[model samples]
Target: MTSFNSKKSLRRVSFISLSFLFISSLFIQGCKTGTKGIESGSNTTLEASINQGRNVFENSCAACHSFERDGIGPNLAGLTRHLSTEEIIDFISNPKKVIDSGNKRAVNLQKKYKSVMPSYSMLGKEKLASLVSFIHTYKDVPKPVDINEEGILEDPIPHQIEKSNFVVNLEFSFQIPASNEELPNTRITKLWGQPNTNEIYVCDINGKLYRVKNNKPEVYMDVQALMPNFKQRSGWATGFGSFAFHPDFENNGLLYTTHTEPIGTKNADYTLPEGLSGQLQWIVQEWKTDNPKGKTFKGSNRELFRIDMATQAHGMQNIDFNPTAQKGDKDYGKLYIGIGDGGAVQMKFPEVANGKHSPWGSILRIDPTGTNSANGMYGIPSDNPFVNITGEKVAKEVYANGFRNPHRFSWTNTGKMISANIGQHNIEAVYVIKPGANHGWPTREGTFGINTQESVRKIYKLTEEEMKDGVTYPTLEYDHDEGNAVCGGFVYTGSNIPSLTGMYIFGDILKGKLYYADESQMEAGRAIDFKEMRIALDGKETTLLEMTNNGHAKLRIGKDANGDIYLFSMNDGKVYQLVSEK
Candidate 1:
């Protein structure tokens, strides 16, 4: 009886080993068949369907399912081994129907996984078959290849700087927005250009300067040094709001900057109390760099001029050396500055002077070489609109009036000055700056009716002519549905991307999409045609590449030293070069 039992146990062990070998052979055969089918294109229809299925899976299913790990849904390992193609098709088409029918696998899946699977019935028969075939092929998936071990580097590595005939090595280092704190919060408000080096400069809301070199970045100047008192007081708002390098920066290390001052007796507005006086105020200072080379920029520091600002918030202090004029000429030193309408809405002693804020809400054109105005700072240009006007107590420097907060204004490639004004509740607008123009703000938002009556009693009242003249209509405007705040962008002059060339690229800070407006579109005075700009990752459109922290897209579309388009993600601090696949 013992010998018979031993023989029976050996037979049972042999049968089990045979069964395991058979299953292994079947898996190996399936893998071989799949590989051959993929190579020969024998399963072309199925493979194409699989590719389509993969796209749908990435966009819709990848969020839940994983082959090796269970995420929102169950792991799909060995699914093909148990379910037939017809059954999978039925289940995928309507998972609820299968579960209701009391199918063993469906009922078990429903019990084990409380979440119900969404139906893919919209995917018709042929497409469903392709997806099923793709699933069947993945039964015994191969391990991912180790590219480093295999010595296959497919993507273009940044370390390798390839030469190109179309490349243009621009001279000046581009400017990036900076903050006093290590983490920058303010958006880029304006951008200016420096001569000879062709370098671009940008000013942020917090008031800091950063220079971009070879697509890399470095801090150029600290605002804390200029506003020592403000640094000691707020510590938060202590930075240069804007800066402009002299046209002849090579000879004269002169530069100008605008910033908020420590609040003494007055707030951001210049309203002062009786007998209680505060000297500290927001001022534009002229400074010289110790280093004229501008390359190392280690120990550069010098003072040139200063202009006291009335308020902090609405002050649009942007200075730029006239590009049209020649450098080194004494009379060629002209600076254009745009100030905002005095602080918060209120009819106060200083704010209601002569029925308007005197020098506030106007553009000032000044000559920095003369010795007529404040120490170091120069007098107004002779051509200023209000310079010779009598009986009116307007400052000689006032060029235009009625502006609220002119965040940024730029000269087009053709030299046309365009300004973007931040609106109140209804609209944000873009305007062409005329020498004596009055942009209606506070009184009106865009071309809409004035915000007058008992509600806005404290604000200035507008006449019929002034109401019409005060409001400047935007060249292009979009509702808040499009974007919360607008970030102005430059026209693409990059050689690598032809489709983007000659198009003005601007974006909304809240929305990560880059909008392309053609020059012709703007010239026609019509609505700008826009499309959602997409980034390609491994030859596919993916949200993973676009989205950042909290699903907020922080996109900085800028140009490289060679005029090639490069995008930076503020959240990840990663930079990407745009390339077209041949």
Candidate 2:
């Protein structure tokens, strides 16, 4: 039995040797073919080889070694001069063999690095050559700018966009009641800009829309006229809400606004309610522009859509028409709306505690031109994720899901979608949307586990493989401990602020702090590491600027036609431009 075992072992060794030989032959062939693509001129060949080598190094070597800085191993800035390309390739492809063969360099490198450079025997010979080429060309020259300046700014221009600047200088402010007694319950929940009139629209918790122009405030619309008992029935006093103008508002005069409407009334003693009582319902209404060219809207209004709330508190609503979207055109026109999961405060009401309703938490992409159905108010887009899926009663307008209070979202100048989700008690998040991503909200908050029905249903616990299959995760996120509420802002494609260009500007509702996150922070496949962000104010003494008694805080940041940034305060009823204190 011992003799038979020995024979079998010998046969196994022989087979392995033969397999290695075959692979080696294939590797050599791949390398030779790859060399053919290089130019014959020595300089050209060297440069081409170096470029290829850099790609290989970044993908394979840089993870282990840094050319000038320490990574997993020592810097290798001049490694090529110490080892020939052939020797380097052999050592990389079979480090153990070279070390055992008594090659001093390999032996020393292994000992000093304290980690064996793993063999890349499976890599084609061409790839190995490219990698060696990259090593040969590496230099230890200092970068022209401070290495720390890497993501701070990309553009060299110093001026903001010209046309955008014009809008920036057109200043205006809103007037709040001088005495708290006059408007004891007033809360400015949101503010909107009318691109056509260049005027600002403000919505107060008291159910009034005020128009501000030339630093004066006038009533734009009063809810009591439309809904007789708005103050008692509308839950606008509790959450984030917004208004939007149709893309063709200049000509069509159609407007849409989102507010919390009461679902029904209930007896103070009822045990179990039939419909939501004092619950917030997301209502989208349309009103004519009264005077398309005027500062105020005065006309008959119609309700477009009213989504019943799962809970009242966390229901945040934001609306915007795609700036790049063209009207009268079928495929391009769209109204993007964000809905928050019913209030993040768990167990505020018995129904929410029982899990019978869905909290307002999702990004809804809809077409407003079609019939009202589960799919949307408009004809469903053929390209919508669920449009072609068979055997499911899914809503096509649901572009993505699993968001908790997506208070704000915007499309980049290049048309990429980004959003900020207000977390429950633990975290706040920012996500970039791909076609049909599931953001994993109540089930998972900011990439961490949370105990919710969605978590129990296996909706939030996605394995890495499942996440890979679909489900785009957030590009950025932060803990509530850092900032209580996240306010989403725009990407800096504006030309004026050189330092702010390419950065994303965002703020916190409670902290009143402003932040600038670099574009790289928006990259996919990585968790946003926010330690590198630049805060606009030092943490010690600066307080976030609050709006005057208008019950409005600095609610939203706006950009003019020129790309300059402006802060709109709901409490102060004022707009402030971000200019150089210099």
**TM-scores for all candidates?**
0.55, 0.59
Worst 10 residues of 2 by lDDT: 10-19
Predicted candidate 1 versus true structure: per-residue lDDT over 421-518, tens digit per residue: 64432344556566766666556544443343221211223346764553445555443334433445556666767766776655654455455556
Q: In model 1, which regions exceed 4 Å deviation?
A: 1-195, 198-208, 232-238, 265-280, 296-312, 322-324, 327-332, 346-357, 374-376, 452-471, 520-582
Question: Which whole-number lDDT from 0 to 100 does residue 543 have in model 1?
Answer: 39
Question: Model 2: per-residue lDDT, tens digit, 532-567?
Answer: 222232222223442232211335666544455666
In model 1, state the lDDT of residue 131: 53
Predictions in order: lDDT: 0.46, 0.51
